[model samples]
Target: MELIRYAFVGVLNTGLGYAVIFLCMGVLDWSPVASNIAGYAVGFVVSFTLNRSFTFRSKGPARRELRRFLLIFALAYLANLAVLVLCVHAMGLDGGWAQVIAGFGYFGLSFALSKYYVFAEGAGHRDAGSTGHV
Candidate 1:
């Protein structure tokens, strides 16, 4: 199923994201939020590549796709930050645990925005079959 493939791709990206955050915070002494943001940036790069070439199998212009991906990531970044802060600051969760808690929401939001808008063919195309490729 396409959803299964999406999950697989997500797993890889999550690993990439976690690795970057772990290195930045655990090794370089960055703040948890700052480290998480850095990891998001790195993971975005990987996700854009993998989502286009492998996940969605997009057949579109690279420049346009990248621009759209960046736009979606900007929104996703805000969403991720909101979830993180809500979990950590409002809910009184540990920083690390908050990130884990936010990951599910991030995954759902990013996948929806990306599959429907960011990486879809042309502008705002919602061809589920075309966009949901492994």
Candidate 2:
């Protein structure tokens, strides 16, 4: 159930992020890299809010959770980049395909980090698992 909610939020985040990226690139004339950065910046806030409230149902200190979430995102992003680079440069894969593979890596890593580190069962003011609403 928790995983389902998390996946739902992820889908929302991905849609919004892609929209932002496309808008930036098409309308604002931003470079692809810049658009991607902008997309991720927006996604970060959306992901954190939804994951905390809807997915994990965390009653944690917002400040603490925000900080940990940021750390987890950074780590996951770095890992994703590493995989992308390895796939594209080392393995001679197509850039588009490499990005798809890297995205999967990022999703799995971010979900685990968010679940265990950012919104762990006992890390919150109330136990995350104690939320009766699921």
Candidate 3:
């Protein structure tokens, strides 16, 4: 049940992110990289909120969760970048294709980190196997 909610929220986050990117690129004429960065920023907030309220049902302080979320996401971002660089340069993959592969890895890693670290069921914040807000 929790996993299902998480995936559902993830899909929503992806859609919202793409929408932001499209708007930025098409309407504002932003660069693809810039648009993507904007998209991910918005998506991060949405993901955190949905995952906390709907998926984990957490009951913790917003400040603590927010700080932990920032740390986890920062690491995730670096890891994704590393994967992308490795795939494109070392494996000779196309940049777009490399990003696709890296995105999958990021998704898995993000899920695990969200569950165990950012949204853990304890440590001064948690709710009976559940988690809370963005």
Q: lDDT (CA) for every model shown?
A: 0.79, 0.89, 0.82
Which residue ranges in model 1 land beyond 4 Å of their true spot?
16-42, 94-96, 122-134
Pitting candidate 1 against candidate 2, the one with the higher lDDT is 2
Model 3: pairs clashing at backbone N, Cα or C within 3 Å:
56-131, 57-131, 58-131, 58-132
Query: Candidate order by TM-score, highest to lowest?
Result: 2, 3, 1
- For residues 29-114, could you state the per-residue lDDT of candidate 2 as single tens digits? 99999999999999989999999988887877888999999999899999999999999999999999999999999989999998
lDDT of 3 by residue, 39-130 (tens): 99999899888877777666677678878888888888788999999999999999999999998888778778878887785332344443
lDDT of 1 by residue, 1-134 (tens): 44565688888988999999999998999999999999988887888888877766667788888998888777877888899999888889999998876877777887888777766674322355545323
Q: Is candidate 2 or candidate 3 better by lDDT?
A: 2
Off by over 4 Å in 3: 24-38, 122-134
Each prediction's RMSD over C-alphas, in Å, is: 4.9, 3.2, 4.3
State which candidate has the highest lDDT: 2
Model 1, residue 39: distance off in Å is: 6.5
Q: Estimate each model's TM-score.
A: 0.65, 0.79, 0.75
Worst 10 residues of 1 by lDDT: 124-133
**Top-down lDDT ranking:** 2, 3, 1
